[model samples]
Target: MKQINTLLESNYQSHPAFNFGPNSWAVSTERLAAFNEVYAAAQQLSPTLDADSRASIRQDLEHALNDIFTAFEAQSTDVYEARFLFELKNACVRLMGEELAWYAGQPRSRFVNLTNKRTRQDTVRLQRDRHFFGRLPEAAAAELRNLAESALGPCRANAAVGRLRREDLSVNSGRTVHALRNVLNREFKSLGVLDAVSAYTGRKTRVTGLALELSVPQATWWKNAIAGLERPPRTLYAHVDETIACPKSIVYLSDVTEQNGPTSCYPGAYEAMQLNPLQEIIGRIVGTVGSQADSPLKEYYAKQYHQSVNSENFRRHFMRLPKCLRFNSHIGWDVLPGSELENELAASEIKMTGPAGTFIAFDGARLLHRGGLMQEGERVALQVIFSDSTFTERAVNKLKRML
Candidate 1:
C-alpha cells in the first residue's frame, strides 16, 4: 500500500470536476494485479462476445482501475480516506461474484441473493424478527432465472437453469442448505458454496452500538444491498439507535442494472462521521457537493435540512446510472480530531457499490447509510446483513473475523 502523503502532497493537482483532495485515496496493489488477470481472461474467453456484453465488461473493469488510480492520490495521505476503499473493495466484489460463480458451476446472473433482510420485500414481510437469512420465493427469483437461462451459451444453458431452480429450497426449520450445496456441486461439477453464500461471514465488531454482521455470505449480501435504498412514502428515516423497541437492520443485493438501484456511495466520503462541526472551520478543509447555490440545500447544512449531507434530504434521486459510474468529491471541509456531534448517525440515502462476488464490510455504527431504490432494470449487486451491527455503545472492534 502506498502512503497518501508521499504522492498526493507531492506532485498532484485537483481537477475541478472530480473533487478528491490532494492526498485522499490509495488502493492495494494486489487488487490491481487481480483485475489485470481477470480482464485478460475475460477477453480471451469471450473474444467473440456481442458489442453490448463486451462493452459492459470493458466499462466495468475500466472503472474498477480508473477509480482506484484517481482515489489513490488522496488515499496516500489521509487515514480517513482509507475507510472508503471502494476501489479495492469493488474489485474484490466483482472478482468474487463473477470468478467465484464460474468456479461453483453457476452463471454470473444465476448466483445472486436478494432475499436478505435489506430488501423492500423483507421490510414488508419481516414483522417480528429482523434476522435476514436463508431463502425465500418471489417474482425476482423467477424473473432473474428466466434471464439467466436465456443468457447461457449453448454449452452453459442447462447448468445455469439448474442453479436458478434451487430457490425452491424452503427457509423453514433445519433448512439443510448443505444438501443443496452438494447437489449444486454435483450438477454443475463445481465447488460447494452455494450454501456458503447463504452463510454469515462477519459479525458486529462492537457490543454497544448496532449488533449486526459485517459481510454476510452469498445471496445474503445481495439482499442487504437492496435494502439500503429509499422508495415509496418514506423519503428518509431517523436513526433508532436508541429509544426504539425493535429497530430493523438494512442491507442490499444486486441484479445487473437499474431495475434495482444498489445504494450510491459518495466516493471517498464513507468516513463522513469523522467530520468536524458545521461551523466556518470545516469549509477550510473540504468542499460540499451540489448547489453551492447557497440556499438551505447546501451540502452539510444540518440545521437547515435537519440532517447532514448523507441524509436523504440531499440525495440526488438517481435513476439509469451508467454501468461505469464516476464520482466527484466535495472540498473545503475538514475531518476533525474526534467525533464532535451528539447524534453520530450513519449516512442516509447514500450509495454503495460492488461487482458480482465480493463484499464491502462497514461499521454501520460509524456510517449513515441507506440502500435507496429498486428501479426498473438490471442492478449490479445483492445486499444482506446479519442482525443490527451498529453499536449504541458502538462496537469497539478489536478484530473482525476476516480482517
Candidate 2:
C-alpha cells in the first residue's frame, strides 16, 4: 500500500491533467482566467465572422489551452483554486447522495448479507500490481505496426458507411488481410496469451474475435456546449468483453502516444467486486453475470452481433431485436458513474499508455476498463479474445437436465 501511494504521488506531478485521487494537479487563478477567455471566445465563434477572423479566434483558444497547463507549474494559487475545488467536491457530494438514494430503493435483503471477509483473493491477486503490461521485440513490434497501418486506408474508406468513435476494420483485399491475420496470430502465440487462458480455465484455448480499432481526432465535445445544432457525441462507457465468454483478451497498441489516448483500467477492482453482492446484480443488468443460456451465442458467435466484419454500417447487420430487449444486450458500464461503487473503484484506476507494439494481456471478462479519450493524434490497436476449447462442454454440463 505504501508503494502504491508513492507511485500515485509521483505520477500526480508527471500527469498534471490526471485526476489522481485527492491529489489533483493544482491550478491557479491566472490559469482559470485564461480558460475563461477561451470559453468566451468559443461561445462567440459565429457563422457571420469572416473566415480569417474566426481562424484567429481558434488560434487564441489553442494558445489559451496551453497556458492553462503552464500556469499549473507556477507557485501562485488563490480563490480560483478554492472555487474550482469547491465545485469538484460539490459534484462528488451530489453523486454520493444519488448513490445512497439508489441503495435505499433496493430491497433491504440486498444489504443484509454483507460480510467482513474478502472473496476471491487469489483471483484479485492475479490482476493486482499492473499485471497486464509488456513489450514485444523491436523487430516484431515494427512489423505488426506496419501491417496494421496498411489496413487503415481501407478502414477509412468504409467510414462513410458511418464511423464510430472507435474504428473497426475489414480490409477486403485478400493479401493485406491475410498478412495482418498471420502477424496477429503469430504474436498471439508468441505473447503466451493462449497459454495463460488455458491455465486459467484448465483447458486448451484458441483465439477468436480479432479486431483492429482506430480512433481519430474530432471535436466531440462541441455539441455539449452548444444547444441543439448537433447532438452530443455518444459516450463509450467502460465494459468487459464477456459476450463471447472469452476467458482472456490481448490488446496490441499498433500506434500510440501520450496525446493519442491510452486505455484505462481499474486494477484489483475486479477481485474487489467479488465481495459485493450488488456487483452480481449490476452484472446481470449489464449482461455479464448470467449463465450460458442468457448469452445469445451458446457456442460463442451464434449470430452476426457476435461475429461480423467491421464496417461503418455494421449495426445494420445485427438481427433486430425489440427495443426493450436491446437494453439487456448492451455490454456497457456495469455500474452507474458517480455512484458509491464508482468512487470506491476510482482509487485503483491506472491509465495504460505506450509506444506502438506494447501489448496488454488480461482476463478481460474480469477487468473493469475503458478506452481513453483521444485529445490529439490518432490511436490504433488490435484486440483478440481467447476461450478454452472445453468451454462449451463444461457449460453444457453445468446446465440442468431438460427432461
Best by lDDT: 2
Residue 33 lDDT in model 1?
A: 53
| lDDT to native, each model | 0.29, 0.44
Candidate 2 residue lDDT tens string, 137-173: 7787778668667678766655545554343434333
TM-score of each: 0.21, 0.46
Q: Report how far off residue 344 is in candidate 1 (Å).
A: 17
**Per-residue lDDT tens digits of candidate 1, residues 1-403?**
2222222212112311122323222355554554555565663554356657655665666565555545553434343223223333343344334432232221222333444434434333222122222222334333323333322232133223443221221121122223322222332112211212222211221111121111211222122111222321122321211111122222222332323444432222224323211111112111232234643334332322212223332222110111112211221111111222211212223333433322233323222234424444333222222232234224355345335
- Please report how far candidate 1 places residue 73 from its true position, in Å: 52
Candidate 2, which segments miss by more than 4 Å at Cα? 1-131, 158-162, 165-178, 219-236, 275-342, 389-403
RMSD value for candidate 2? 22.3
Clashing pairs in 2: none
